[model samples]
Target: MRALGSNQAADPPRYNATTDLLERNLVAGRAERPYLVREGRTWTYEEVVEATDAAGSGLLGLGLDVGDRVLVATRDRVEFVFAFWGAIKAGLVPVPVASGLSAADVHFLLSDSEARGAVCDGASASAVLPATRRSDVPCVLVGGSVSGEGALTWEEVCGRPASLRAAPTTEDDVALWLYTSGTTGLPKAAMHRHRHLRAAPSALSRQVIAMEPDDVVLSVSKMFFAYGLGNSVYLPAAAGAAVVVDDAPVVPGRVEGLLNRARPTLLFGVPAFFDGLSRLEEARLPDSIRMVISAGEALAEDLFARFRDRFGLPPLDGLGSTEALHHVTSNRPHDVLPGSAGRPLDGYEARVLDPDQQQVAEGESGELWIRGPTTFAGYWRRPELTARTYSGDWMRTGDLVRMVEGRLFCEGRLDDLVKLGGVWVAPGEIEEVLRGHPGVAEAAVVTSDDGSGVPVLVAFVRREPEWDGSDLPAELRRSCRRRLAAFKVPKSFEVVSELPRTPTGKLKRFVLREQPSTRP
Candidate 1:
């Protein structure tokens, strides 16, 4: 296991990610193998390469220069893949944003990225069109009528003969930009180099899953997210496996249908998605599925037991971030611990440290710091933040965790901790206890100020449909009293239809903290 700080050559010095991922298959005589399956259609490795080549040529012809930024706001489809690799092949930085963003949000991204052009599907064109127009950048429609003047359809741009030559990009050159979820504040762009794409597959996919060329993968997350990008694009390509792409929303019944149709050997989803699937009477894992990976947020122990009992395979919970390309630490297939995030991946190193930058004792919770080959170069245009986030090569993960018998157990994020009555409390501890109670489907804990401006804990719970709500709050309080300190107990329990989440299924805890507390 080699770390990035070591002076060794994991990848060649003059490497281009697009050229390497696509050309390797052809070199290995796998050009005819199926690489992408979407909506009943499949594309061979050869076909994908040609499409990406054409896409690169088309973008270069549009007066976009090398190193220019191109925003890709499209749904999870073949076209999104094409536009992404195409820009990278042309030596242009591709910034992929969520397809479902509002017009104003899209405009903000366009301006922040200073993108020279954009690619959008019909579903997202309404937002991207106005955003690109407002930003004065060229727009290319992927799969719909061109509604705006000067906007070109994908075919019109890439129909001509394309040059097979790829841009000269080194391993250290910026390949793409992934934006943070903005759970705490405004979104920040993390710049990843060409070599970073090769790191995750080697460490997590190859080592933990033992992924093989014959395996097929399916994910509920969209390509814009870092987790989804690894699952659908780079990881599969590196492993020489096939990926099933679905643009449909993640409904339990719909995912079940997709499972039956695709028969993927491995599935990737967030804990919330797995929880939803566990509730459906019609949901069952296809016999082909061998493992399930849970990410984007921590997986509760109760939900993990329920999923394992229902599906017969334990969900591998991992912790990763946009700063790292994908998972740096993850639970392996056969060595899973229900609530732990597992050990660091083969090529990554993790350490839990105190506020003074000294390593904490084992089993003592502290801030997590990780150093790995997949670490991002830095935040785009935010030098001060980047400086504060890194110490030499180690990147602060912003997560609070403890090491127990070689496994990493996450308590919560440092920013989410609530200081109640002069004692710091981890909300996850209270939420876990609340979730362990019967009929509690989901729980999120946030801080609310009491009448004297003292911070107090408030829990928002989503209960089972059949569970009686009469006196449930009092019962929940009693449950907490038995398991937690009095200060750690939530002062109020508010039952809601659903908790707020980001597009990628991450809890928007800030939204909960901002709402006026209904304290009694």
Candidate 2:
């Protein structure tokens, strides 16, 4: 078992993640330093500390006991930040879910987490109220319109004494629960400890990005995402740096607006957002951006080259998961492989193994397994599934990857591999080839059931605005034939306005697989 990064897992017996992230700034005389900048409003470290203190006290005053789970569903706003850290500060576990989920979806999370309390904005409240009503869970509403039978308004919560003492939590104590992106099935909550939060800063951010106190980070992902939570919240907090927050939809125009306004030193986004930025003619990346990190999905080599050609900087592609908390393997600033997820971070271990539980040779595809101090403890309330997911201390990441020269080239999900004519094919390879075509703006390949119930390859393509579909199907076929084997080429192509994606910007192949292909 070859491990790439250092092992620096030493920590104090008793630790509080929220306290470690926030109080250090004050102790270092950075009380007035900007912590969160949104629109024209800037919250200093002192201000955030005060607000989080009040929020913590408020949750405690609501009769919520220590170790209770609190569902935090809100946009990427200051209130969301306060509620999350505040819960941790008060010894409560915060389960942050995507705010864009439907009412029924939000309800599922509330019940699944067995939440004792919920903090939501108006939109999230609408999604949460019906469920909380049935469960009799206490609700605290923040920002925007507040309405619910027994829900406490943000103003009402803060009306109480605005002070709190950090909880006496051990390093191993559960600090938060992050739900997985349920692309394959229902989402499962990944339990993380206070110590896990402390490890990522040293492991990835500090060593890979060289994050410093004076830097400002702009993350296009919402705070609900594992990538966003690390990039926008804890990493910045741990570094005593500032984060730019916004609830705006991640369109190229809005992202450009943020880039021009925030002038962030670092920009964190997914491959889709990066692709969008590369397409927008007027999109401007400021000179202040020292690094751009891409994750959540595999970054294509063509997209990597196009982005580099358009902008002087190439995106440092990386791989991380909800189970891993933050980045496990990442491309460093100076040492980067465009299409590959670079070496393991400063304190993590990664390995590729075959189905027989033996290590695979270099350049051979296999399941990627990772183990680190910050790896999530277990799935909440699912012991059997957790047992199956872990092999000793190593967590099976479910990702298919090949290691070459210590860099990982991620193929796709293990479940996503399609077998056609007895040969298994990776959809990412076909999709990457399709994306290389000049007329194709975006592409996704999935196995769909034929009329006889046998699965066949179907490609869903979103054409560029200027493209005419007159000869695209034939052109695309030729493109695929030139680049891929006969068995790997998509059997049929379906031109669509948009490709289905999850809230986190991951392609929803399951959804695509279920939909029928219209074009032959």
Candidate 3:
């Protein structure tokens, strides 16, 4: 890990948003040092700085102005990173829309965020262009042919001068607007600023991952998601470490391949990705893998144990949201406790408060709230939501959790609980019970209406080959009845090939609830 400068307070806190941390650090390093890698090609720190500068100048020449929002809907390519930093260099806010979003969702985000421009890849460029047309935003096609009228190619933009610079940005100025995966409703844009970028490397980088200059970090999420963007792009760039970018989402086998090819010391992903990778029979992970970090969703203890059994390394679980830049609380590798998102990172404070906003006793579950440097400025254009979510400096995480010996145990989302006969029951508890069954590979429990039109618990099970779905539902129901309250046992069971999930690997319960009942 590189030595961070003094903790001593300086006048005005030395905040500079004109130049990105990547450019500043790269310019300070020797020109020949490798800073980025993609498909066996090495880009020196100086080369990366120059490439981003060229891309920035191109966007400027294309009529982008200060504070203009540029939407990046692409995979994890080296050029994608360049375009992202380029937007920063031009004083334009970069909004990374997920390339996998539905066409309607894409149109909604473009309109909602009021993006003035978009840069898209070949696969999604066509699908997104029509949506962009309706919003009157220009589209810049990258790794794709320009088909839409008035759309410009990435080559045209990069052809501009690399010497252009933008006016300085302030700490409070919005730099990015990331949309949260709308598991419940339409995705809301979480506003971030230049100062938020400084928090990850400062608080969570060295303490949790112990990142080193020689280390290669492989992020399993896309650059559009906050976790992936911070872990793979920002942290490595700021720490002067090497990062690997692949223009593909992390699949089960591809994750193992990337690990072997990059020989990364650190791997970051959500729990579902880890679960899928653990299921692979041929994944021979490199011995150089020193750390595995899990975030984006709560990790199951069984998944953690499976990882430990397979790789001999426990997956460190962290709790965070898009509202908070990356992670507010993470378990360090050496100090990790199973099922606990460890104590607050340095320079942050956390609390578990009851409905009255009073502190709860230890070992009691309450709403988890945090006050940290990485907390977002606010939600974009949603003053009512901003006031509801933010109280003074503390950001309400909307997660229900309990604290034991200062460690946090994620119970479930505050809204994920279902009322059965007037008693609150967490769906995760039912899912956990189903996961303990030997035949179950993956399980999701959701509250849905039965054929008779009353709210009933439904368990969707993806079973191993030997288990018969026909008989397993009854067996699992009996098991749950023995372990839980009679009313808490699932009244309906449906076998599914796979559960729908977001790009970040969170189970899409909203999608699951829309399915017709499989019950008789």
TM-score of each: 0.96, 0.96, 0.94
Off by over 4 Å in 2: 1-12, 159-161
For residues 1-520, write the lDDT of model 1, one tens digit per residue: 1111222445545667888876678855588888899876999888888898888889888888767888888889997888888888888888988888889988988888788889998788889998888788889998788897767888998655587577767777788999999888888999998889866678878888888789899999889999999999988888788999898888889999899989999999999999999999878889999989999899888889999999899999999999998998899877888899999988899999999989999899999999999899888789999998999999999999999887899998999987776778898888889988886889999987667777778899998887876777888999999999888888888888899999999888988887776646
How many clashes show up in model 3? 0
lDDT of each: 0.86, 0.86, 0.80
Clashing pairs in 1: none
Please provide, for model 2 over 1-520, each residue's C-alpha lDDT reduced to its tens digit, 9 standing for 90 to 100. Answer: 1011112356536678888987788865688899999888999998998888988889888888778888988889998888888989998888999887887887788889888898888767777777788788888888755565878788788535488998867777888999998998999999988888978788778888889889999999889999999999999999989999888788987789879988999999999998899988877799999998999999988889989899888899999999999889998878988889898886788999999869999999999999898888888889999898899999999999999988999999998998888888988889889988889999989998889778889999999887766878789999999999988888899889998899899888889988987778
lDDT of 3 by residue, 1-520 (tens): 1001112333324343436567656544545677778875989778887888888788767677877888898878877788888887677888887887667877888888777788888767766788888787788888767896867888887745478565455565667778888888778988787778866687678778778778888888778888898887888887778887777767879778878978988888888788888888887789988888899888888889998899888899998889988888889977988888888888888999998889999998899999988888777778899898988999899999998988899988987888887888888778889989878988888888766667888889888666655688888888898898888888888888899988777888978888877774
Clashing pairs in 3: none
Clashes of 2: 0
Write down the TM-score for model 1: 0.96
Candidates 1 and 3 compared by TM-score, better number: 1
What global local distance difference test value does model 3 have? Answer: 0.80
